[model samples]
Target: MIAAIALAFSFLTATAQAKVLELHRGVGVHEWLNWSPVNEDGTYIWPPYRAEQEWLDSFRKGTVSKGENEFQRIRSMGFDFVRLSVDPGPLVSSEGTKRKEALAILSKAVKRITASGLRVVFDLHGVNQVPATSMKLIYDGADSEGVARYRAMVKEVAGMLVKVGTDKVAIEPYNEPAYYPCDASGTDDWQRIMEATVADIRSVSGDLTIIATGACGGGVKGLLNLKPGFDDPNIYYSFHMYEPHDFTHQRSETKGGFASGMPWPASTSTPEAVRKALEARIDAAGLSRAEKRANLAEADPLIAKYFAENWGEKQLDARFEQALGWAKTNAIPSERLFMGEFGAILMTADGRMGADDADRIRYLTAVRRSAEKAGIPWSIWEYANTYGMSVIVPKENAVPDMNMLGALGLMRQ
Candidate 1:
């Protein structure tokens, strides 16, 4: 009788512990898992990797070969999840051979990541970006040919998920899907395509969690307008937070020309400094006084729009509140809301820290803490890099940016 009771107790304990885990705190592991490496020639490579076969084999064995213990390091930082961003183009091909090879590589990665005890959000990122090939299905999946191709990709991926099992995995249909205006029409179009994609995935695996997002590069406003067709319990809505792009992406060539040396709080001094910088730039361009004034007029609003405005904790709070309000209005629970990406660029256009460590820390702590307090799960944009907002500083001996980690509360000391 005693032995039977003990066995029953053990069984019950195991059952109780097998709860569905939600991704709360996480960091994006990034483009490594995404298959988009280009060859030296202008032509794109097939497997999307530029590395040698031996190194690629090691990656399958859970060794990144990039001289870092990725899984162990992420766990040590108290992050519960890693959003593996995957590029779908290279994974799906007209010929079965290339597609199968890519899937095998991805399968190895998913297995290695899951075995490390970290939850994985397998994000189908960058499908919307115009690829070298003539596939526009990601943008026009609502159409006939587009929908057919998109559905096929999802179907194949869902089958793979069945093999990986949905224990610690979730699928994000697309990343940063953008359409103009973000109005009712755009939202409806996105909804139609997303519904189709979800249906396609469900046809293969009904138990897998599906993450949905809106258009406008998956911004907050876009997410606000996204409404899932069915009230499925396993669906999550994700938004990327990089508001006041001038403030966040300043000095990055990606956003525009270099916009560096901007402050967080946007004091009177901040704008004056910006104005002076603008004037100096205009002067160097050999513009006359009238031309310079015109240039300043043209540039002033942008500076004010991004930085001169009040952008303290209150601003950040209000931004988040808008999302929370939308969620409440839609009857969506907070647990179903997620901020999938948020981070600041550390490097300036000239390749230096844009803001002082103190200012950057203050800004990071405010945004991250605010999101957490709102009961929303969040992930930093990246883990390791020298030029971006990465917590790990790259070197021969990689080192953690303690200040950045401290700001995110990942480091106490």
Candidate 2:
């Protein structure tokens, strides 16, 4: 009798543990992830390439590894998710041989990631024969025909994922929608595109999560104003947060030209500065007095739109709150809101090569903490080179400040 009781207890304990593990194993309904490319040489190549012949040849020849090693390093750094870029053209080929090859590569990657206990987000980074500028389907006079072509391509990709039973894989319709231009009229057209794309994906697999990029890549205001389609729980909103691009793309030695030694946009540090800058620009443009006054009033509310009074040491906390409020107002649950891209570029006061590691840590730490507080998921801008957080081919061998990671409560040690 005693032996039997002990055996029963052990079996129940094991079953309970298994259930707990299973709950955590699948792609999370709400969680954070990091984005990066898987280069052939296992190192993430910085500054993602457009579909140029020279770039393609170099990438294929292993001259540019999209940082596979860096991805592993990111995993080691404690990230449980990854967003991989798939050039839609290559993945969806008219030639059966090319399509098979692409599928094989993707399948291998999915298996590898699953084995490593990570979830995957497949981003249709670029479409074939289409330049990056015109890749998105949302812009005015956008190749409507091209948009249809890419929609078909996405359906094909979604079909493959469904067939493979890879539930962890989600699809991002396009990488960055606002890299081109989309006015109010274009925005309406893009909504139709989004509705169509979502329907196509659902036709293949209703379970797949469809990530839609917002205007200006889902800016907070745009997201709040959006009225998503009817009863699509599988859809989510994504927005890139590389605000004040002038700071993020400061001059570098290798990529010469443009302004050299320009400082990070001062406006980002405070809302008042941002408002003042906007006012000055409107005034300088020589708008009619009435127009200028209207513009100023219109912009005034935006200054305090997403801020908190007691933001404290966490400045990003206010920003996150503002963004979350926008999402909530739009009927988007916290789970559906994500910080799709955000990272600080390292730049010296004199505009030199090495970045300010301390500042980078502070910025990232604030953002991470804010996301946790807001109950919103987030992904770092990148896992490697371009933004200076290259884990595999770091710009310098300097040891990471473990304390900084700890400050963000990311590193246990």
lDDT of 1 by residue, 1-413 (tens): 99999976775454334333488888886647554654565334766543333333432443345655467777888888888887776665434777777777777787777877888888877543335432355566376666567668767877786689777888886888766568765536677777788777766655677788887788888877777655466677888888666667655333233345556766534677866865665465576777656555655676777663667777778889888888888888877888899887774434322554556677788888888888888888887655667767644445577887888788666
Between which residue pairs do clashes occur in model 1? 251-259
lDDT of 2: 0.51
Clash number for every model? Answer: 1, 9
C-alpha lDDT score of every prediction, in listed order? 0.69, 0.51
Identify the candidate with maximal TM-score: 1
Task: Please report the TM-score between candidate 1 and the true structure.
Answer: 0.80
lDDT of 1: 0.69
For residue 86, what is the lDDT in candidate 2?
62
Model 2 residue pairs with clashes: 39-65, 39-66, 42-68, 42-69, 43-67, 44-66, 44-67, 214-218, 306-322
lDDT (Cα, 0-100) at 60 in candidate 2:
30
lDDT of 2 by residue, 241-266 (tens): 55433334433333321122222223
TM-scores of the models, in the given order? 0.80, 0.63
